[model samples]
Target: MAPTLPFRDINVHASPSHYAFSSPSSPSSPTLVVDRPSGDLRLHDGKLLGTQRVSSIAGILGIIKLRLDKYIIVITKAQPMGRLKGHMIYKVIATEFLPLRERPLHDPDEDTYLSLIKTLLKTGPMYFSYSFDLTNSFQRQAESDTSAPLWKRTDDRFFWNRFVQTDLIDFRTGGGNAHGFRQSLGQQPGMDPYILPVMFGMLEIKNTSIKGKPLTFVLITRRSRHRAGTRYFSRGIDEYGHVSNFNETEQAIILNDDSSSGLGGFAGDLGYQNGKIGGAAAQERQVLSYVQTRGSVPVYWAEVNTLKYTPTLQIRGVESATQAAKLHFDEQIRLYGDNWLVNLVNQKGRERRVKEAYEQLVKSLVSAPTEDTEADRVTREKFHIVEPERQKHELDRLHYIYFDFHNETKGLRWHRAQLLMEQLREPILQHGYFRGVDPPAVATESKSGTDRRLW
Candidate 1:
C-alpha cells in the first residue's frame, strides 16, 4: 500500500513556541516549564480529529515503555496528525515490527530514510529514548529546502533561541529474542529535550560503512518547517567517503640526539661540556621506524560506491496543486540543470505535464486565503541544519533500519550508524533555497559499497 501519515498524534500538550525552564518533574517523567501559554499539554485543542484502535499490547506500551522490542511494540496506523496553512502532518501510534524490507515506511513524497538512520547511529545503543519535541529542528517538506539553516547555534544549548532540556526516560531495544531494549545516557536518562526517537530520524548523512550485516532499508521522517525558497538537499556517500586517507610515509615522528654534555641531566657551571652521550641517548640515536599507519580512503571516491539520493524542492511561487506537480517534475531541473535559464527550456511527456500544472498553480497563489503566520514565514525556512539542531526535526524519528553487509569492520559498522544519523539532517536550512536559489548536488559517487581505497 502507498505510505500515509497522520500529524495530529504528537501535539498532546500543544504547548506554545516558548516554554519556561523552571518546572516540577513527576516520578519517572522528565521535567518541563510549568508556565506555558495555556494549561493543556497535549498542545492541541479538545478535538479528536479521528480515532482508530491498535489491537496489540505492544502498540499501547510502545507509547510508554522504552525497552520494548521491535516485535512487541505496536503502533497505530498512520493518520493525519495536524495541518497548518502551508502543510499537513500525519501521525502514528508507534509500532514494533515494521514493514518488509521491500516495503519501507518512509515519506513517499521525499527521501527521508537515510536521515533517520544517521540519528540512530550517533546515539547508538541509546540507553533509552527521551521526551520528543520538534521545535529546535531545521524542518522542511523536502530535503533541498535551504531557506534558514538553524545548525548555526548561537550556543550549543540552544537551537533557535529555545533553551530546551529533556529527561532521559531510558532507551529501549526490542531485544531481538532476549536482547530487551534498556539503554540510558551516560549516567542517567539525558536531560536534553532534543534527544529522542525523532533525533535518530533526522540525520543528514555524509557517508556510511557497514559490517557483517548489510543495511537494506533506509527510513526517514518528515519535518515541520516549510517555507518559500527552501533549498532542501540530503546526501550519503555510497561510493565516496568523507574520511581522508592515511599517509604510508607520514607516520608519527620522534626526536633523538646523540651528543650530550657530561651528566646528560641538567648540570650546573661547566657541566658535561666534554662528555659523550649516555646509554639512553644512544638508544635515542636509533633511527625511528614505522610502527603502524591507518590507511587512506578517498572520500570523494568512496561516496561513489555508497551513493544515495534524497529528493529536494521548494514551495515558493506555487499556488495550486498543479504548481506542486510541476515543481515535482522540475526536480530534474534542480538536479541536472547546468545552464542559466536553460531549465526553462525543458520539454518531455512528464516534464511538460508537470510544468503545465505548476504554471496553473502559480495563478492560484494570487487569491489564496489569508492566515497570519506565527513567525516570519520567510525567515523560518530550513537549510543545512547543524548536528544538534536537526535532532528536533519531526523527520528524524525512524526506528527500523537495515544494514546490508558489504565488507565493513565493526568500527566501520559503527560509522554506518553515524552516517545514517548525519545524512538525515536537513541541508541548507532555508526556505528560499527550495525556491530554486541553487541546484541540488548531483549523485557523482558510486554505490558499490566497497572498502574505500586509501590514497
Candidate 2:
C-alpha cells in the first residue's frame, strides 16, 4: 500500500456554477468540485474558469442537507492537539458551511435546521488525524488490516461524520458514476485522500519524564453517537439496548527507553501493525493503554422535568427491562469480558427504586435458564462433572457492586471513596490492562484475547 499524504492546506474557489477545492502544496492533486444545481461532487483536473478564491481551509468535513438545500461543511481553522506514534492529531477549532445553492431559500424551517446543525458543530468537540485512525484504540488498530483505508476501518459508533460522508464514500466505492469520474481523474482505487473521518471526543496530551525516561501521557474520551443527548432529555436503554450519554475514556502512556530519541524520529511511523513497531527507528517506544466506560443505567428509567428543582423520577417497561438488560450485558461481555458493574446511586429515597430495580434485573439474568436441548444438557452435565469450577466460572460472569456516593461523601469527607476502591481492588487487579511494546515477540498478550481489548 502506498503511503497516505493528506492535503494539509486547501484553497477554496467559488464560481457561479460550482465550488472547487484544491491543494496549494500539491498542485498536481485532483480538485474536488461540487456542482451548485444538484450538489453532486466530482473530481476535476483543470481549474474552473471565472472563479474567485473564497477561503482557505484545513479540510472538508462532509456535506449535510437541511430542509431546503445541501451545504458543505469545511474546517476553517484547526489546531494541533498532540501526536501519537508520529501522527499529528488536530482538533477542529472553527468551521464554515457553504451552501450548494446559488440563491438563498426562503423556507422558514430551513433556517431552524441550519441553526441546529451550526449549534452541534459549535458545541461538539471533534478531533481528527491524517494518518491515524482516531475512531479506534491502539489495540484495535494493531489487530486490524493495515492495507485498508482509514475511513473504511473507522468504528461507526465514534465516526461523527459517517452519515454525512455517505456520498463521498459511495463515490469512492463506485456506487454511482464514480468509475467514469475516477477514470477521467486518474485516481487510484485505494482510499480517497479527500475523505476525512472526524471523531467527536476529548483528547489531552502531556509530555513529561518519569524516572529519567521520556514519557507521553494521553487521555481520550469518545462519546457514542447512538442515543446521545444531554442529561434529563435522554435516559434509559432503548429497544436496541443503546443507553444515553455513553462514553469510553482511555488513558495511554507512551514511554521511550532511549532519552536521545527526538519527536522527529516518531513522525509518520504508522507503528501499530500486527502488534509490531513500524520500523527499526521506533523500536524503543513502549505503549500502555487502559480504557473504562460510563453510561446511564441500562434500565427503563427516566427523569421528567417539570419546572421544579428536582424532576420526577419514573421507571417504566418493567416487563421488558430484563430482556433489555440482558441485551446490554451480553454486548458488554462480548466486547469486554466479565463486566464489573459498579452502581453509584443512593440506597435510599427516590434513588432506592432504581438501585433495587438494577439489582433485581442482574440477579434474574444470572439465574436465568439456558435453552438447551436434551443432548446439550447431557454434554453439559458431563463437562460440569469433569470441570465444575471452570463451568461455574463461565456460567457466572457478571459482577455487581452498589455504593451510595452522596451518603458516603457527605460532610466534605471525600476520602470515603477508599471504601469503594477497597471493594473493587481485587477484581480490577485480576482484570489487568493492555500494553503494546516495540517487537511483536515481546508484547504482552491479552489473556481473554480480543474480548478484553477495549475499544
Candidate 3:
C-alpha cells in the first residue's frame, strides 16, 4: 500500500531567502538584518561582538518548539544562490539557532511546523544549497549518547558547515557573545539535522500483532536530489548523466522491538573493533535484515544533453553500457553484500532484453573475480535468481519492497505519456568507499551460531 506520511514527514524544500539576523535591540524588540553581497555578517553585542566576519548568506527561519518555549532557528547563510564558472552553482548550506529556555518541554508538533515553514520558503527562487546543520556544541552532546546510535552524530562530510564556531552569533542583552542569548537560560549544545532528501516524506509505520509476534511495517521513500526539479521544466539527466526523480521506496518490517545494530567506529572502517570479538557476536545482532532494491538500474544513458524533454536513450555502445552496469552492481554487492534481493522493474516487453542482459551480467560479474576464488564462489552462491512462483514468499521476509515503473501513472514529462518514472533505489548513504584500506578478509558465519573471527 502507498504509505501515508505524517505532517512531520521529512522532505527537502528550498528555504526562504529574505529573512536575516541582527542584534537584539531591546528585551522586547528583536531585529532582522540581511547580509550584503560582499558576504559579511557582524555580531553587534559587546565582548568581541562585531569582531567575527561570517562570509555566508543566512537568516533566521523561525521559532520552533513553541508549545514549551520559543527556540529561534537561524539560517547562517543568506541567499544560497551563486554563480560558478558562468554556470549557476549550489553548495551545502549551514544553519545555527539559539534556544530561549534552559529546559524546554518536548513538543511533538515541532517536526510538522518545521516542514511547513520549509515548504512555504520554497515558493520563491531558492536552490543551490545542500543542507543546514546546527553548530558544534549540539553535535558534541548528540555524539555523547551511546544508547541511541541513530541519533548519534555522523561524520562532518554530511554536514554543510562542520567547523562553525560557538561565538559566531553575538547575543545581546541576555549574555556575552560566547553564550547564547542568556547564560542562565539552560541552553544546550546544538545537533545537526538530517537533511532528508526532498524525494522522501516523513517517517511512517503500521503496527500489528501477527500470531504472537509484534510486527511493524515501516516505509521510507527516497527521491534522488540530483537534478530534481519541477515536472517537464527541469532536465531529467544531470551533467554526470544520473537520472532525476529516481525514488527508492523502502518497506522494512521488524518482527520485534529492536534497534538496528550498526558497524561501530568511523564511516570508512573495514572490519574494525566493534566491541564484539567474533563473527558470531555480529551474527547474533543481525536482526533479520531482508531488503530489496528496485530502481533505475545502472545503464549508460542520458536525457539532458538534448533539447527534447525525454531525450533518446543515448546508448554510447554495448560494451560501455555493460561496463556501467557492472560498476553499479559492484558497489551494490560491496554495500548490501551478496544476499539482498534485486528486482529490475520490467518495462513491458521492451526491457526483456535488458533484463536478460542484466541477469547474465550479474552472473558473470558475481563469479568472475578469480583473484579471490573462494570469495567469488561464495558471492555467486549468495545471489540466486528468484523463482517466479515463490517470488511473493521470497519478498515476504522481514522486509518487503514493491517497485513500479508505471508509465501511465507517470506520464511522459518525457514522452507521449506525460508519465514520470520513479525508481526505488537504496539510499546513497549505503554506498561509500572505505578509503585508504585494502579489502578486508571475509569472515564466514558458522552454522552453529558461535563466534567466528571476522579479521
Where model 3 places Cα greater than 4 Å from the true spot, the runs are 1-34, 40-202, 207-216, 227-249, 253-290, 302-314, 339-349, 356-455
- State the lDDT of candidate 3 residue by residue for 1-455, as single tens digits: 21111111111111122223333222222223222221122222322223333323233333344444444454444342332111122322444444444444555686566556456444422222122111111112222332332222322212222122122222111233321233432322111111111212223445565675445554434344444445433422333534434443434443332223221211122223564322322222221112233334344434334675554443333345555544444443443443233433453444444444444433444432121111122122211242222223211111112122343224443342221111112322333211211122322321211111000
What are the per-model numbers of colliding residue pairs? 158, 0, 27
Candidate 1 error regions (>4 Å): 1-202, 205-346, 367-455
Clashes of 3: 27
**Deviation (Å) of 375 in candidate 3:** 32
lDDT of 2 at 427: 69
Model 2 TM-score is 0.81
Residues 40-104 of candidate 2: C-alpha lDDT, one tens digit per residue: 67777766778999999988898887776889999999999877866789999889999877555
Q: For model 3, give the 10-residue run with minimal summed lDDT.
A: 446-455
For candidate 2, the clash count comes to 0
Model 1 residue 358 distance off true place after TM-score fit, in angstroms: 0.3
lDDT of each: 0.22, 0.71, 0.31
Tell me each candidate's TM-score: 0.19, 0.81, 0.36
